[model samples]
Target: MVGTQHAARILVASNRGPVSYALGDDGELTSRRGGGGLVSGLSAIGPDAEAVWVCAALSDGDREAVRRGVGEDGVRMIAVERPVFEAAYNGIANSVLWFVHHLLYQTPLEPVFDEDFRGQWASYQAYNAAFADALAQEADRGAAVVVQDYHLSLVPAMLRERRPDLRIGHFTHTPWAPPDYFRLLPDDVAEEVLGGILGADRAGFLTRRWADAFAACCQTLLGATVTTTPAGPEVTWRGRTTRLGVHGLGADGDFLRERAHRPDVAERITALRAETGAGRKLIVRVDRTELSKNIVRGLLAYRQLLTDRPEWRERVVHVAFAYPSRQDLPLYRDYTAEVARLAAAINEEYGTPGWDPVLLKVDDDFARSLAAYRLADVALVNPIRDGMNLVAKEVPVVSDHGVALVLSREAGAHAELGDDAISVNPYDIRATAAALHTALTLPDADRAARTKRLADASTALPPSRWFLEQLRELQG
Candidate 1:
């Protein structure tokens, strides 16, 4: 039975929380805070507000914590049955929603929606229902509930049915698929996902383009009526109107600056500075080897730049940090291998006795990434699609020498920083190569000026303020 407590509380539901725990050999539980915009934003909300972070247990440590019954910092950890969790998280959310929105899958040979997919869809629902039940159990009467990302799309509707008094908001940290692509989901699932989101009092996207795409999907698929308002886009369906909003998540400048100056970062900077050599311009890109990240394409573009412009042969070095991501998935593993192979080919094609043209590292090192960001003369972030690529924002904020950004038009960051960045079509190898050249050659004064504006835009809604703003809007 759901009881309505009169006190208002802030409830944040996401696939992962601000902190994760580790179990040591001594059976002691150690905790560390996680990074990202959400964690920053939640930390910014200040200490006065009563809040609870609801997250899923993704690892053995997390499962242990869940079984023991609470996250380190009072977060509620839910452990759905393993098979169900994997099918929902890996099957539907990552495979279906992520691919459809990013336009990653090869439509002809993939996306076979068979009995296996149907079973996964059922698991996805069960996963979401588990979250909804947990959230409903925790939320106070008339509490402000903010759900995060595609992993929990169905939670809004499920929770709304249980707690109508709660002010619900859903924020997508990824691009919403256009109606045609979104309809690729079985008709019933498509309707339910849209209907689930529409159950919220407010649904927020990283950009107006994404918000509009979502509204279009609702209009086309569910025949929901959408109207423009000063507040934002409003969708009315089945006598309930859900307000849509464009809320871009930005970098935490204060935190980054402090972290960038740490001892580890200082050591990394000295090491990278030597690797870059003297008098050579450094073009850097730090990305996990996610298919949507377009790491291989970015490497190819760099190769094309070397091929087309011979003068830059020994003068520029492309320092690429291609960290591994989702290695459990065959597609991701293959993509990472391809990134490595292409990078090696570039080195073989362009390496001189003194200069290795492409220095590619697959290790995950935050200090090294920041060191590269500071040294970057040109920062390349060419993703096929992104909710908001924070690297695009973080580089400008930390660059010691003014860094010119070569951004992907497909990234959500483009809406905020594209005017200053040399924008390129993610699919156009030649165009991306050209943009990199332009970024590398921009006047120092121009680069500095753009860096300032870009930094301002990137930090406009720092984590704490971004979270608080949503809470205000939902309550208002």
Candidate 2:
């Protein structure tokens, strides 16, 4: 509403916005801005572009701000009712869609789509409708609207129905499931999801593998026609062709390097070095305790390294930052607890009078993570399936002495950095342990050269460039 004098020509729609509000005990509201690819991309376009970001009001303060008509310039927050939000977000999006896309469901036990699921699906539709309505109200005729991630898969189609003149684009941040895996959803549900995405003028993914998987799902489920062209793959459904493009999000190398050297990060680096002992090597991983991150398996691999290679017992330390995520879901709560318990078991088994082999911290501290990145001798990023593991690209850019990357083949970043990284199957603990050993023992010169190449590739399509490229293509 801040820029209500004129309609916005460009729009970005997502679940979370660039800023959030907090209500202090003094009954006052304070706003904190967030940083990410979308934020950077929007900034790169400048205010002259007249872009409006449409997002959900996710917190109590945010809801209050919306009720009060308090908002940032060029941002609109839709306050969906709490019950509907929970049903759509936690019930459907996180529990069902996330599990399907990430292949996290245990085949015989889960995905019972009963009456409860149907109700949640209704709420999900309502959530998408809310965003579509907001965007329809704010966008100018022929405005380019970009919708983000799985949470709003239905938004593009809903918006299209309301405003056919608008240019619509949908980008999926998670890996797209293959036809076989995606078919796990009920037939009608799967078809609806595919048709929803096909309503876009263009659909973007992080890698070619995911993009192809999306097309395969559309063809298999919706009888869509897919063809390859010099530009990219195109999917034709119901007499409309939607172009598919890959925009692999990369590390903000300049920001990471600059922030990693700041006074706060330096203090954390000194503290971590003191705790890790002077000559011991540091193996570092920073991730949310999301099931797809495979943190438990990563810890088990570290344990295997200690058991198989005794020479590394006192010479190496594993520094893990497994921050909490989605604790509202019982599955994620259990996963977070398991990560903590396993870390304790390893430390209890390996700690000596002066050496703690595993230093585990569950707090979410960005400065500390940057410090660990700068100090890492071997960076571990072993996600089961990821759209793109930016940590695999980030550590190399910030490492003070150059770190060897132990990456998983399943990660989307592997498509870009596999040649330089020590790749392993995420499910094979022994192989991952071996990869870690190989990373640790890599020759200093070789490691430095690989790190340099990784840094270059990681920054090739930075956030701003990635966003601008997608906008340009969608505009065309």
For residues 205-299, write the lDDT of model 1, one tens digit per residue. Answer: 99999999999999999999999988888999999999998888889899889889889998998898788788889999999898999988898
List, residue by residue over 144-255, the lDDT tens digit for candidate 2. 9999999999998899999999999999999999999999999999987888888899999999999999999999989999999999999999999999999999999889
Candidate 1 lDDT score at position 187: 97
**Which pairs in model 2 have colliding backbones?**
none
Q: All predictions: root-mean-square deviation over Cα?
A: 2.0, 0.9
lDDT of 2: 0.94
Tell me how far the alpha carbon of residue 170 in candidate 2 is from the true structure, in angstroms, after superposition.
0.7
Off by over 4 Å in 2: 1-6
- Alpha carbon lDDT of residue 117, candidate 1? 96
Question: How many steric overlaps does candidate 2 have?
Answer: 0
